[model samples]
Target: MSFAEEAWVPTTETECRIEGWSKETHQHGLQVRSSAEMNAQVVGILPAYVINFDSHNFGIEFQIIGSDRGWLKIRGAKDDPNRSKLPIRATYPGIGWIPGEQVAFMVQSGSGHQRPDAESAKLLDLKGDWLTSMGKIVRVVACSGEWVLLDYSLGRSRNPQTLALKRLTEAERRASQGRAWFRGVCAIQETSCETSWP
Candidate 1:
């Protein structure tokens, strides 16, 4: 489907790493499905892993190209971060698919979790310049099938855990650096962050 974007130039290639399926996957790891649908095919079994979520069972972050339905696609094989938290060790660059829904990218606007240079992205806005909203967090600007393009700040500020542990205000941890291509079906959008961490 064609979508008109009002934010920055949409990007497919990203320097930042994307995450998928978050669970206590210490058993036999997650299965890399051959196809997009469930029960498609267990092409491979990836060892359970964890990302930057502290204690959660997430795999290492890497260049996840895109997603289909609820799965994140790995462009090339990626391995879990070298460590014990990885449950089972899969060499480097393990190949597979991730359940997109399992990821919770809840970005809040006005919390430094929106566009890094939103004004610049607005300046780069191709169409709907007037409609360019740096408002309401990162609004869905465009979509290629299940992938929606938007800007977000990935930093300590975005993590609720850090907020409570560090006793920091969201404003202090803001780090919206650039845009990201995400499965629109799975984004957890938030405009007001009234729920502050205790």
Candidate 2:
């Protein structure tokens, strides 16, 4: 995406530090974009919001972008009973997945969001930010309270070693399925944050 202005919270901010976040250099490097490139494709007329949960501190950062789809707010941890206070939205980004293919979920935490403040967090400037996969997209569902789940199937024969759009054999699929699992991280807003990569 065209990062007009990069917003980062530094390696400080007890709740949003970026030191301990998972970092993976994408084998298929992403194509960076410019503002003009961003204008080329409409992320749609609407904007996408982010819901950040700090499991350690039990705080959440609910941020929204403006009409320009720019981030509007960040680091909202106040105790507000009004759910509307946290405006959250989801974007498909046209990331596809197949019916029977294995897929992975990657998340950026800690200093991941950078500016934890309201101003920096509201930048809805996602242009070319995407993850390319070998699967086809089936459907995406949104839940109440700002939760969006992407449902997709992974073919048992897709080879992870072959990054250039390839599949594996039945034996390879079985070996992969045997070790499949899910894990998460915890961020102590304004205190400490850590990530677990498997």
Candidate 3:
């Protein structure tokens, strides 16, 4: 279907993030179906693995490219810093279809300003002078289908804007198993990092 023909909606507007299905819900892992229906061909599997959220090296992130009938087609972030280093082939250029129920859309009320804590993130190209230059260091607050809510700090002002995901660099890709061991170990514990947040 054409991009214009598809009915794409953001999973969450407040936070702008989408989460994969948890292991508790699907023990075998999240399957990437060829179509939105249950009988569709199984294209791949996004394994269900747990990570230490308290650690700096949390997990890989995916960008929603398209959606239909409660199914989302996602791909790895293009400018992910760890993409080239990941061992899994599915992650570096990961792309597949997953059920809508398998994903969690996060929404935050208010401005919901989160301290810039992500190790690294790149701004997607907005093709407009009003937006920050493509690939500029940005603090990604949340992401939905096609758009990412980013915080661009220039001097004293913090500009929070939503831009297309295609414009950003892929900083990291999600592995089939949802485990990214290449991020290395977090030198500081969660408690120590908490003190650093503003």
In order of lDDT, best first, we have 1, 3, 2
TM-scores for candidates 1 onward, in order = 0.39, 0.18, 0.35
lDDT of each: 0.39, 0.23, 0.35
Please list the residue runs of candidate 3 whose C-alpha ends up more than 4 Å from where it truly belongs after superposition. 1-27, 51-60, 77-93, 110-198
What is the C-alpha lDDT profile of model 2 across 44-145, one tens digit per residue?
211211133532221222221111122111222222223214444232222111111111223221111213332333332112221112222232111111
Comparing 1 and 2 by TM-score, which wins? 1
> 71-159 in candidate 3: lDDT tens per residue?
55666522223422334434333666665445432211112112212332222212232222122212333334323343332211223
Pairwise lDDT winner, candidates 2 and 3: 3
Off by over 4 Å in 2: 1-132, 143-147, 155-165, 168-198
Model 3 TM-score on a 0 to 1 scale: 0.35
Give one digit per residue, the lDDT tens place, for model 1 in 7-83: 33434422224432334245676666765568776776655545345543344334455555445665444454444
Better of 1 and 2 by lDDT: 1
